[model samples]
Each structure stands twice: as structure tokens, then as C-alpha cells.
Target: MSFPDFAKVIAALPSDDAEWGPRNTAPEGVPAILNNAPYAPYSKGDKLGRMADWTTDSSKDGRDGQRGGRQAYNRNFRDQQVYGAGASSLFSLQHAEDEATFSVVDNQRTSTKTRGGFGRGGGTVFRGGRGGRGGQVTARGGRGGAQGGRGGRGGRDDRYGGGRGGRGGRRFGWRDFDKPQRLRDASVNIKPDWKLLEEIDFSRLSKLNLETDEGEDVESYGSLYYYDKQYDKITPKGPEKRLQISERAYYNPTTSEDPVIQQLAERDEATIFATDQILSMLMCAPRSVNPWDILILRQGNKVFLDKREGAGFEFVSVNENAIDPPMDPTDGNKESINAPQALSLEATFINLNFAHQVVSESEERKFSFENENPFYNPSEETEPLASKGYKYRRFDLSVSEEEPVHIIVRTEVDAVIKSPVGKGDQFMTIKALNEFDDKAQGAGGAPNWRDKLVSQKGAVIATEMKNNSCKLARWATQAILAKADLMKIGFVSRANPKDAGKHVILGVSGYKPREFANQMNLNLANGWGIVRTIVDMCRNMSDGKYVLVKDPNKTVLRLYEVPFNTFDEDLEAREPVAEEDEE
Candidate 1:
């Protein structure tokens, strides 16, 4: 009664037809299989967990179920081959309608459900949201959100702004993950009492457009030396000419600090004042990605657009709007030499010297303006004055018969070139584009200047137009502001990619300012509209100092009401501390 004899039991069972094993029956013409019935190949190592498993159907548990089934079976029997797996797609179910046509409706309201906090109904604190890269937090909900029904007790709201399409989780834009998150500090410190009057994004600024007539010259100062045609003849061919550093005096004063603009403001020549540099920055702001601040000082009816002592606007940016812009100097990165800051400095130096070196310094060849240089002092300045001319121009920005707005901008001319068509001497604005390393990150896929500047010049220029859109736009704007007949762009690149110290000139290309603006799709009307909008904002406000700051991470401009003594106090505070440190 314990057990049956193994040999007797095996002998008694039918040897030809075993019930638990492969059948021995064969079809008439079948070569592979012994059984006439359909057969599935089995491996010795296959995990035969169940004779009939039912949970693997995708319809039963959704797509997750199919994934789980694959995971479970694959993990246990990875080496085991399944028969008829190739034709398994034939058994899969087909949908009656396209999946793309279907949509999901999320009707979740703003979560006003309160949390534990010190408030009438507990308060909800929002730590971060879209465009909050710098760890900015907002406290909402609780008693305050009760009326809005978008936060607080019994209200359905998200931590971020809640609406039908509230972004509740991490928000990403096109290819946002390719670059590291950046948090930039403001140009000027923000005091607790400063009030934010306006916050405008690039979208709004880009949409603004207003046509204005050519500005009339109010006054002119300084002198412009004739541009030497010899430099233009040089090509980026066999032997490259090294870019020489010149020791010449060049004046680049800010708007509010300029005595000429101050005098114009005092005389009430215009309701608004700005320098070409600052004006160009505001005009080309929609294309910029770097952080910059423009100081708006209002006295009675006049508003002046100015810059800080050493603003980022002073230096020309390189590949700022590229998908992967030049990174900051990190600890161990060797390519940090091509960092945005370093490139800007090198480009700035190249421009300063290129303008001076290209122009003929002869007094006889130079053309004098209506007045002498306002900022230049012959005795105080040891270096010879670089060729430059400034013109104070005024444009009308009146909306209707009642409101007449005028803005005076001090525009600069680098030099003058003889008209190619023989229509007298033509005014010109000179700027140089420097190449750091074409192979470097954030090079914006630019070609090697030495190789391409001579043959594939159009390709080089097109790439530059894409990579340095903001910088080129600013230059063109400045040229137009000055009413320059020609805009000269010089191609300059480092002698060696690894060495940022030395550079060489490739060649020069010239284009009319108006024509160049059109090529870059730079809408002067939009720029004028931006100026008018900002002027209107200041004109409506009480007379005070205001600062317009560009958000680094996002395309936004925020205007803050600053105390009259904010920057002055900061300078004063630093002076004493600096003196003490010196002691």
C-alpha cells in the first residue's frame, strides 16, 4: 500500500502513447514533428510554470499587463526559444479608430485643499514651478484663495498658477534637457522696498510693431577718420595677418552719464534720451538670452535709458542664443577658455582695435562734425583719440494729435568710406566677429574661419547670422541709428584655437544698414514699438529711478522701481570697504 513498483507501473503504461510527454503519432508527410496535431517546440531549460496562464492578455490589465508578462517570462526563460513567436503579431487585436484621434480629459480643479500652516485655514506654499530655475517660491492658498476658488480650503488648485491647463509637474521646452540649468544673478541688487511695475516677455515685445520716420539730426559731435580701403583688400588666404593691438583712446560713455545727453535732457530737446548702444540693446532685446539691465531715470517729463558702469551690454556676446550656449568656467573643464564671458572679452578687444587699426589716422583725411569731442581731453589723455563721430538724432513717437513723444539718441559712427558709386564720403559703422574655436561646445556649428572665410564666405556669414543674431542685430540697429551708409563686418579669429590671447583678421564684408536689417529679419518698427511702450510706461509713472532687467533663464523683462540712492549707496558702501581692505 506504500507505493507501486516503478518497473511494473512503467511497463503497464502505453509506451507508444504517453499522456504527459510528447506524442509519438506522426503525420503521413511531416518531417520535423512526430504528432499530426499542431506542435510548439519546447526547450529543456524552459520554465513551464503553468499549463494554462490567463493574466498575460493586454486587454485584461492594459498595456502594463503585456509589459509585465513579457518581463516575467523573459526573466525566467531568456535563453528559451518560443515557437510561432514570429507570427504572434497575427493574433494581436486591431483598434477600430486611430489612437491619435483619442484624447484624455483631466477635470482636476485647483487644489485649494489646505495643508498645516499658520493661517486661518492652513496655507499651501509653492516651492517651484515653470520658469522658476532659481528656486523662487510663492505662498498661496489658505484663507486668501477661498474667494478665488483656485486655492485654500475646499478649493481645487495646483501649487503653480491653476487653470484648465495648469502645469503641475516639471515643465520642459524644446530640447531643454540638452543644456544644464542656469540661474543668473541680477545686474543690480534688489532692495526689499523696490516695486515691480511691469513684467513683459519677448513674445509680447516681438509682436509689437510701430513704423516711424527717419530721425532728424539734432546735433553732431566728434570727428570720423576716413576708412582705409587697404584692409578690405586683405583676404583670409595663404598667409594670415595677425590682428594688432593698438594703444589708442576710444570713448564709450553711458547714456545717463554722458554730458551731451545730460545737456540735451536739461534743454528739453526731447522727452526721452538714450545712447545708440543702450537703444540697440532694447531694440534687439527679443533676440537676447543673456541677462542685462537698463537703468531708466525719469526727471519730470524726461526718461533716460542708461546702463550700469560695467554692464554685460558693453561686451558683444558670442553664440548666446545657441541650443547649447558657451558654458561658464567650471572646475575641471579645459574648454572653459571658450566660456561666454571670456569670448565676449576677447571679441570686445578685437572690435576696439579693429575699428582703430582699420581707419586712417590722418587729420587731413578726417571729417569734423558740428562740434568737437565732448568727452575727449587732449591734455589728460596720453593716447591719440580714435576716429569716431556722434550724432544726436530725434524721432517722433506721437500716438495722436494730443500726445507728442520724442526720443533723442546719441549715435556713433566709426569711420567714413569714400562712396563706391562716387556720391561723396559715406558714413560707416565698424564691428568685428571673432572666432574662438569652431570645434568647441556652443560654437553654434560655425565653420572654420580660415578655411571657409575665403571660399565658403556665404556659408560662414549664414552661420554667423544664425549664431550671433542678437549681436549682429544690435550692430545693424546701431548703424541705422547713426544713419550709417555702410556697415563693415570684419572676420577675425584666434591664431590657435587653444590660445585665446592672439587673433588674426580673415577679411571684411560690407552691407548697407537697411539692407542688412532686412537680411536678418530685424524689424525696426518692432524696436520702435518697444521704445514707445517703455517710454509710455515711464511717462505715466511718477518721476523716479527705475531699472528694466532681462530675466536670464526666461525671455522676460521686469521693471522695478529703485530708490534714487540705490546704486549710489552701493558704490559708496563699497568704496569705504575697499579703502579699509587696502589699509
Candidate 2:
């Protein structure tokens, strides 16, 4: 209990030599089982720490401090020796395989380096051979150090040590060179039995030009109604003015199906016959992105241009040349109802309804052509006929008077407006551009029509010219063929941004056909030249059916001689089924 008792207790304890005596020695009566294994001793200098110290790594040492790499050692106990440091090698496993060959993937990018002035001290060397130490630099260039080479006073060296102002051995614009090319599918399948006749690219077709005079009218059919000026007075903002759904009878018979074209072919009137739609596509082939095909049927000597039932050419493509065009349902994109295919069908539907709804479809105000509607039958058809006028025009494609080569085309006019002189009417062609979703991908940077149509109609039309270049070009070409005085473009958008079922008209803009052609850089002579070239190719062939298809992947057109029954199955499938009258 006192100091004297504590001193006696400490003096009675064992000395240091005895406490540090052989640990391999067995206790008083126990057998020495571990005597041959040798004692693994610890140092007295080692400090007592936690049972399991996890914060131990070479990189954690103060001198080797590296962030985010390893656990840091405690500075207080850093100098103390570890208890098992000497015996660690005895417990470690040694295998014959080398572990250094293993690879590890790291995604961290290096920090950007600051640009330094030339002839100054070189930057830090991270990886590479070192340059000549304190030697005069050669005129060619100085060799790069570990990180990359440095520019000298004599010449500018590249990062890869390229000679004198050279781009390091690295390639420039590699992104474009390495980008994958898109492979698109053809609009029509080429059967194995088909024969290849020729392949014509846009580059070669654009070089050919032929100046031809304005075509002369052969005959006219169908009737057109006066345009109702009240429709143009609608406000070009908001959903207050919505498009009306007007059901009317409209016909789209192919060139061969036209009774007049067949009669002309029988009479040997000309060497070639085509519709305005087909002719315009051929003429403006160089500007097209979507693929199309025209069926060429050559009988004895005359050639007829026709299209398959439900062909892609029936609909106009929106933003066909956009950097990121609309994707199809199968392309893995969220297939909104407003996909390219759907938008095209919607555009076609809009044009048909817009033309019919804007016209005063009255029996008394209608103007009849030279002949009655060729495809319309009042007795069989129930719906009122739409306002459309068909004019058959003949163009001379002869190089000389001795060899006269003529082609006839069927063009259509949508509506008629009173002339400025108040004597006659001025024919017009009506077309519409529909917007699905401006915020959606592949919109081609189109502005909201409802917001900009009233204030900036010219800007809106210019955007359409850029995104729908091929479609607008075809429309202009058709108007030119019909010799129309004005071309009208209607801006239409969805009534609801997310809904594709309903749409409303935003505004209407009109331009003279010739002036619009000039603004769009549409060359009629170039188009005629393309038509003549194709006609010449088919003129010498034997009597059969030929298909001229635009290559989907490249800017080229290929002519193939297909069997006469190539598209017969589709036609048979499309036959209308009679419906029972509802109560």
C-alpha cells in the first residue's frame, strides 16, 4: 500500500535479459514441438498499434504522397518499425508465373498543357527519348523529349516531332476520314432475274444541258375552280385557325394508265411520253436524296414512263438532306408517329386537302378545260371532284429537223385566280409544307411556323428550300411544265405538338414560277438533258419493261431490265375490295 511495498514488488520481477530469452524454449513440463522451426522474433523498438492496420501502402509514405491512389500512413508512427516487417517474406507465396504481363485499363485523360514561347526551357518530359544535351539544334528540327518535342528558334516542331512546321506525324481531320459511311437500302428491290443496263451518276448528268423551247399544248382535261380569297385571310398564328378536313375525289393515274397517252402511243405521236411528276424527278435527280424508280415500258417504238402502285415518289420527303434525318421505326429510335415515312404520307395528305379546301368547289364557278375530267366518273364516284386541271404538253427534243424527237407530258394546275387585267384567270399550283415537332431530332433547324410565318415568311420559305430542296424543286418543275403563273406554298403545322393526327394552316406564300425557279437554281435545260439521255438509253433496247432506280447509297441511277411481271403481284394485292353499305 506504500512506496516501500511497490519498490519491493518491482525488484522481485525478472530482468530484461530473462524476459527477452529464447521464445522457442518449452515451458517447464511441456515438450518442445517448435524447436526446429526457429523463433521469429520482433524488435523492442516496434510500437504497439491497432490489431489490423489497413492504412499501409508505399504510395502513402510522406515523400511519395499521391492523391486518390492509396491510404496514407500516420505521420506520428511513420518512423517506427513494423512488428512483422522482417518475417513478412517468409509467409509470402512465390509462384513461377510473372504478374507484370497483366494489363490494366485506365480512362483518365491527361491534363491540358499550357502553351509556352519558343526557344524557352522545354516542358516536362512525360514519355519519349531525350534530345541532345546542350547541343546546337539542327535546321530540320529538334528531336522530341519524353512527353513530346518542343519548337526551336530555327523551326516549329510538331508534338510528334514532325520536321519544320510539320503537323506532328498525326493526321489532320481524322474524324471525317474515320467516320463510317451510311449504307441505305434501295426503294425497290432488284430481283435476281433483272439485267443491269447502265449506271449514271449525278455528276455526269449535271454536266449535260439542252435548251428547249416552251412546250405546246396537245390537249387539256379536268376542271379547276376559282381560289377562295377568304382562306388566305385567316390569321397565321395560334390554333384559332385550324385546317378543315374536306373529302374530295382526286386521281393519280400513272402515265401508261392515261387513256390519252395510250391513244397517242397508238397513233405514234411521239417517241417518249411521261407525266410532269416523273419528268421533274428525272430533271432534278442531282438534288435528290431519297431513292425513286420509274417504270419504262417500250412497245414498238414509243417509250412510256410509269410508276409502281404506292411508290415512294408519291409522297414528298421532309428534311431529306438533313445532317440527322428522321429515323424509321426499325432504326431503334423512339418511333413517334411523326417519323419520316409518316411525315411524307402526312405531307401528301395535307397537299391534297389544302388544294381542295382553299378552292371554291362550286359547279357554277368552275372553269372547264378543253375536255372533261378523264379519270372522274360522276355516275360511279360519290365524292365531289377536287379542283384540278390536266394539260398535255409536247416538247421538241430533236437535234435537227431531219430527226424529230418529241416527248409529251401531263401537267396539272390546282386553282385559278383573276388576272390583273380582269380579262382572264391566272393558273396556280398549290403545295404545302408540314411541321411535326421543331424540338424533335432531325427537324433540320426549322423555326416554329406559328411564331415566324406572319413576321418572316421569306425566312420560312428559305428554310424549306434548304431542308426540302428536292421536294420543292420537283414542285417548281411541275409548275413550270404546266406554264402556271404563280406557285403557292402553304405552311402547316400540327395542332398539337405531340399529335400527328391533326394539323392547322399557319400561312400562305406565293411566288412567280419563273422567279422561284431562278431563286432555287432549278435548271430546266439540265432536266431536259437528263430526260433525253435516259430516253436514248431505252430507245435502242428491245421491247420489254425496264426499271430505272436511284441508288440508295450513292448519287447514281441504275437502269435494269426487269421481267414484265415484276410489279404485277403488288398491283393485284392493291385491288379494292367492295364494302357493304352501312345502316
Candidate 3:
């Protein structure tokens, strides 16, 4: 064909077009979207490598499996003894006995439990790794091994190398191979590559004058965190970013006053008002875990005194330390009221827990105690506060801001160490059993015994802590002062509860102090010897609430009438403590 004729014929053949173009594609066409992935060069057709290895259904053998896959292949390996001759690799017909493991739980060792699988617990090494089941798997088959024997591996046992549960062995598996600490918690000892900064010596890097301006000790004008104000820039933290740790100290030094003089000053700068009247004084005060130190500066005249009797009697506790320092006489600034000779009392709350471990295995040590906690108890039920795991119990020892009082608590722990057997630790009331020891040292040949066990022993006592009995002692001062006649405030404990009834108040003491001196624990010199009369009326109150109020000095009643009960209000059991305001 000539060139011109061939071109003309090609043009004429294109006129019968059926809308075929490169833009659109037919449905379900794989190459519709051009894939940029690389492709191997084309080759010849397929062919068998080795006669198709006709035994295609051959089960997975250790040779064909990935790393650590030999365990499964070997686990089912037949027992050679079953065969009469040399049939070594034959599968065994005996049951897979060690398929699951048993976990120890409870201090009493009363229950039985078994777990299986390594899908979760770091290959049976970490306590949390076994069974993939956390606190929710509480089957009662852990203590008594789920089999015929006392500790035999049976029901729910983790066989095939899951070391936790009952008798679980460490099996080779592709899932756990090459993974460091397959079932254990390893320390995150990260060493960062400092690069050029490696030459920096961090131990003695530099000195920084970090100026802190947070809180000051009320009694001592020193800073909790020291800071130097001589720095270049100063930034006051906004109210939103600031945090208040505790109640503002009872005393504060003015900005103009010298810190040294504030320390030397013997009296407080502020005067608490309206406490002169016995009822008002007691109600308006902040509650304290420490019993208030009450003292009478001068005895009121028995004849000339206002004839108010019973709850209406006018009374006041003089706190000489609450007196403010005398004002400088030069500025013509005369003081409004002279400092009262007496003031409300102060006290120190005591904690029984000491530096040494006094309690071990739910009982006090054979020897003596380190620190004396008068409120210590041998039982397991903690009183005055309620708790659950993850969060500790906090109660408002104070009634409210309106009636500010001392802040107190029952215990300090996130979870309760519920004693499994009998009366548990008296301080731990919550029922949370997360105690375990997958790494228990003494458990010889036992598969991760500690990790899967739940213990009843309380928190390891290594610090000083006040016992729950301290609750009764908290209100000793107030109870003796305001509630003396009506509330029958005394150290009378009706020790009959289990065999008798439920209204047993406190099991601490039967020695109630009605006189002002013993109520505030004042020295003998500060008390009135003429009113030297304290009848041990509550001595026989061992089994009843009817406390006898014997007349001190055998003095007859001025107005003869039986004292009847009136008020039944409770100011305790307030809500949680509110964070103090930044202002």
C-alpha cells in the first residue's frame, strides 16, 4: 500500500466508534485504577517443585512451624513405651494432665482455683499475665486443686507452659519467642541517646535559685519550699493553677511585722469570740483530732454567779496562748480589749503506728511496741471511716466551715487489706483482694504461686498510724464540756456486743473525766483543789448504758430533779474535706 493510501484507509476505518475510550472502565475490572506497585518480570508457567509432595494433609510438625513451635509438636508426641518395639514418635493416648494450672488465693487457704491460657499473662511470668482474666475470674476452685489429689493439676489448669495456675509448664511457642519477659514486668530503664549532649554532667550540672512563694508555717514564719526573690523575672501563679495543701495555719504574721518578732511573740494575734458562754464556746470552735486543752483561769463565784444551771450554765475555757502581744503605746493606738487571761485549749493528736513494724501477720510482735498508740486494736474492722479499693476513706472531722474543727481520718490506704480469716485488720474495712505474689520466693517448684493468689493480710505496716479506736478519743474534750450532763460523755464501754446487743459504744475505756482538769489533761497545779471531787461513776458500766453520775464530795443537788435526755443530734460523719480557697 502507498503511504497516502494507507493513511486514508486508517482514517476511514475509525468512523464506526462504539464509545470505547481510556478514561472509563467496565465494572469489576481490576486494572480500573492504575496501581503503582512494582511487579516481577514475566516468567514461564507454573510447575511442581518436588512431585507435589503428595502428603499435603500432613499435620504441622516442629520442622514446618515457626520459631518455638516445637512445644506443640512435642506435647502431642506419642509415648514410645506404648509401642512394643522402636515406634518412637508415636502419639500418646494418656490424657494431657498438665494442660491447666492452679493459682493460690486467700490467707486461710480455704478455696480452690485453676486458670489456663497464655494469651494474656506475660507468658505466665507476670501475675497479671496469667489467664488473660483479671479480678473478674473469681471461680471458687483455686485452693483445693480442681482434681482428685490435694494439689493435682486438673480443672481449668493452664497446660503447655503457662507457668501460672496449677502446675503450668513453660512451653515453647512461636507467640512468646524472641519477646523479652514474655509474661513479666520489666523495669523501664531507658537510656536516651543524648547525642552531642552526652558530655553534660547531670550530677553537678548547675545551681538554680528556685524562689517558692506558696505557704508558710503558721507557728514558724519559714517557708515549706525555699526560694530567692533576687531572680530576674517574677510570675505569680494564677488562681486556677494554684493548689492549697492544708488548712491555713491558726496564726499568721502580718507582712509589715518582722519574722523574728513574730516567732518570739508568745500570744496569738487573733481572739476567738463568743466562747465565754459554755455552749457557744464549744459549738463555734473547729474540731480537732487532738482533745482540746481546757482550763479555768478563775473559778466563777458559786453564790454571786448568774444562777444558770444545767446546759444554760455560762462557762469558758481560758487559752492564755491566744492572747495578742501588747500594741506599741506610741502611736496613740489604744487596744480595744485587754488580752484574756485564759484561752481555748490546744492538744496533740497521737498516732500509734511507729517506725518499727509493730504488727506482723495480723498480730503485734512478741516483744514491745516502738511508738505508743493508746488506741491500738487487735481486730480487723476499722471504724469511723469507710473505704473501697482504689480510693481511700475520708470523712470531715469538722462539721462544716460554719463549725470549723480539727481534721481527722481513720486510715491511709487505697485498697483494704481484707483479712481472709476471722476478724481482719481493724484498720482495713474494704473488701478488695488484689494481693498476689507471682514471684513468691519460698514457693519451691510451684508455678507462679504468688502472682495468682489473693491474701487476707493487711497492708505491710512499716509506718506510724493511729488505730481506729482513736475516733472515740477525738471528741473527748467536747463531749466532756458541752455534753457532760446530757450526753453522758464518759469512758464507759459496754464490752457486751456479740453475746448481748449492738449498741456497744466504744471498746476503748471506762474512765470518763467529768472534771475540767482531766478533760483537758491539765497539770494538777492548774486545777481547783476546792472542787477536788471526781466520782468514778462509770466504774460498773461494763454491761449497760445507764451510767451512774455520783455526786462529787457528796454534795446535794441545788434543784432536786432527775436529769432527762433531750438532744439526740450527731455532728460527726460529715462529707469529704473541701480544698481550701487560694484566697
- lDDT values for all models: 0.75, 0.74, 0.21
Which of the numbered candidates is closest to the native, going by highest TM-score? Answer: 1
- Candidate 2: tens digits of C-alpha lDDT, residues 154-209: 22232234223121211222243553455567889888999999999899999998
Show how many residue pairs clash in every candidate, following the order shown.
Answer: 8, 2, 60
What candidate 2 gets wrong by more than 4 Å, as runs, is 1-182, 573-583
lDDT-based ranking, best first? 1, 2, 3
Model 3, 298-327: lDDT tens per residue?
111100001112221122211111111112
Give me the displacement of residue 493 in model 3, in angstroms.
17
**Model 1 pairs in collision:** 110-156, 110-157, 111-156, 111-157, 112-152, 112-155, 112-157, 142-152
Candidate 1 on 1-583: residue-level lDDT in tens?
1144434334443565325443456423333333454444444465444353332442333322244344244556665424333223334565555555678898753433334432333344344322211113323323322112233232222222321111221121424575466666655666789999999989999988888988999999999899889888889775777888999888888788899888888888888999999999999999998889899998888888888875668888888877556777662235767877788888899999999988888976789998999989998899888888999999988888697888999999999888868999999999999888765666765667777687778878987888889999999999998898999999888889899989888898999999999999999999999998987898899999999989867899999998887678657878988999989
Model 1, which residues run further than 4 Å from truth? 1-179, 573-583
Error of 2 at 575 (Å): 5.5
* 2 or 3, greater by lDDT: 2
Query: Which ten residues in a row are the worst by lDDT in model 2?
Result: 165-174
